[model samples]
Target: MECAAVSAPVSSHPPPSQINTSPEGKKPPEHLRRIIGEPPGPIVALLTRGVWALLTALSPAARDALARFVGNLAYTLGIRRKVALDNLAQAMPEKSEAERRAIARGAYITMARVVVESLPAGDRMTPDWDKQGIEGEEAWAALKAHVATGKGVLLATAHFGNWELVGQMLIRFGVPLNALVRPLKGALNTRIAENRLGAGAGLIYPKGAIQEITDAVNRGESAFMLLDQALPAKAAVFVPFFGRLASTTPAMAVAAERTGAPVFVVMGVRPPGPGARFRLEVEGPIPAPKPGEFADPITEHTARVTAALERAIRRHPEQWLWLHRRWKVQPPAALVTAPSPGLTSGPAPESAPKV
Candidate 1:
């Protein structure tokens, strides 16, 4: 179904899916707001805020260099450094170890920039998002047009580039967008979550949100969904990413198929320069499958969308977070290997333990 024709949005928030929204800043009367688990909440909060402040204090150019330097250093020493390198090797098999290492190093810096831009202070510093960043004008225009057409845009993006900045950029330009915010326990996590909301984005708790997301789209509002993470077998549909069967969520695909909502990809891509500035592009309205071509239309569509994400990441290998254990879940026996002629199919091998 095409989403290029609606004229109005149906709701400001999410689904009648009756989701539980986060309580970030408001101090309720109960001690329920205090640190739920361990890890010394006070220290973690202080360090996070302090780093945010320090990054803010530096000039844009200086901080940009520092972010990259720190990222590289962290990658060199990080427990997950090998993970990142391994991911890169698998994702870009043609690349040599040195090349993969370079990509991994750049990924750490990209992550640093992600962390910095996500900080509350970063929002304060970036008052002129339009002036500093370029491109994405057409993409944003497409999003506005799609949502205006009445089929609310089903936003699809990966954890590449400055993913968060895409929302911030839209908020800067007065476009309303909502995305799922993972619920983290503890008062500090709440505050950080609140800060994100305060910076001009809306949140939708993940549980029970199908109809809620549909309702939001029906209203001509846009909801952002990150589809590049590793999903559990229960929630996952194995899809080819970098030529491997990585478990991916089919929620967006199913939503589009079920509701006829238009799907769009909104990803943040930063150009090469001294400072971290993004070209937050929102592109798509991926056409629905014609049906009967694949065994499952949902898996086909999900894989198609994921392929688009892979293409985007390929363009800027350094910007994607390679440190993540994106391939932790192995393909099931049926998909991993076919039975040899006159022989039985073998079970899939186990993956290496995560670091």
Candidate 2:
């Protein structure tokens, strides 16, 4: 799975420009600019770079241990602790309190490790797939088949284990991949964009990205979209997740239905061990909707893809991002009684308590 044969991508798209310069169209004081560099204060800049250097310098095992330590500390400090526990309680009532607590702690650890692992720059961003033991032959085949049609491919993913690595793996497999990402703030945004582009993946910002995504796909390029995030009711279709209706964006489904592109749910799984390389799990080219496939193919497609993600998360509950308010938006009472287009029929759960 070494990508030695894969050449660096020569993208026609322009690289993301730096946007961290002074706000008033004025330059920062020379000394301050030299030290802090951008909107994030000097202390933050130094701290971020310091942590990155420390994590990068450590061996993989040590890095994992340190990440675990940070995660445990966060859990102990009650950082989003209630949100995680509440999510677990709602999503996995079958599990005992002790089990759920362990899962929450592990979830924190996974999040920490994701951040730490993502901080490395350049070639280190591309993992050794053989070392990771990523099993994706079927997925690769499906991707190739979809791309061969020249209709493009919709790669549906989530905030599950090492999601960043999944995109890198796709690029390594020589898939011309573009991802829809929410931009970070200040210098961090520029740095992350640079890293993604450096890894040979194109970045698609969420604002006004629909047309761009469609155009990119029209050109036979694959687009990666994270389908698990919570969205406003107007922008989302209700779908069953863990026995509750979660407000989910139907972008992937809409794109697939509109463009005749195949949708594949891909994620990375972290096997239990010290410094274990993540395993790639790809499920789909999920069956496309037939004409008049019941009603509202877009909603049905969204549910099917959401179900795929739910199955993956169930396999490793701790690896999924439990801290996010996944079930935050509930359908209005009228819609709950008489479900509208793009909505599944269900009694809305009480809205998630504000964090």
Best lDDT goes to which candidate?
A: 2
Model 2 spans with C-alpha error above 4 angstroms: 1-43, 125-128, 131-139, 148-151, 186-190, 338-355
**Alpha carbon lDDT of residue 239, candidate 1?**
78
lDDT value for candidate 2? 0.67
- Give a tens-digit lDDT track for model 2, residues 182-260: 6455555545555555555666655666776687788766788888888899988887788778888877887786777
Instruction: For candidate 1, list the clashing residue pairs, or say none.
Output: 5-149, 6-148, 6-149, 6-150, 9-219, 9-220, 10-219, 15-212, 263-285
Candidate 1 off by > 4 Å: 1-52, 122-128, 131-141, 186-192, 338-355
Write down the lDDT of every candidate, Cα atoms only. Answer: 0.62, 0.67
Q: Write the per-residue lDDT of candidate 1 for residues 1-355, one digit (tens) a residue.
A: 0000212221122222211222222222222122222333787778766765776677777767767777978987875998998788788999998998888888889887766555545343332345543334455566676644655567887778766666555444434556655556654455545554554445665576577677766655566778878878878888788877888888888888877876766666776676545665544555566866556778777876776677678777888878789989886898778411211112211210111
Error of 1 at 218 (Å): 1.9
The candidate maximizing TM-score is 2
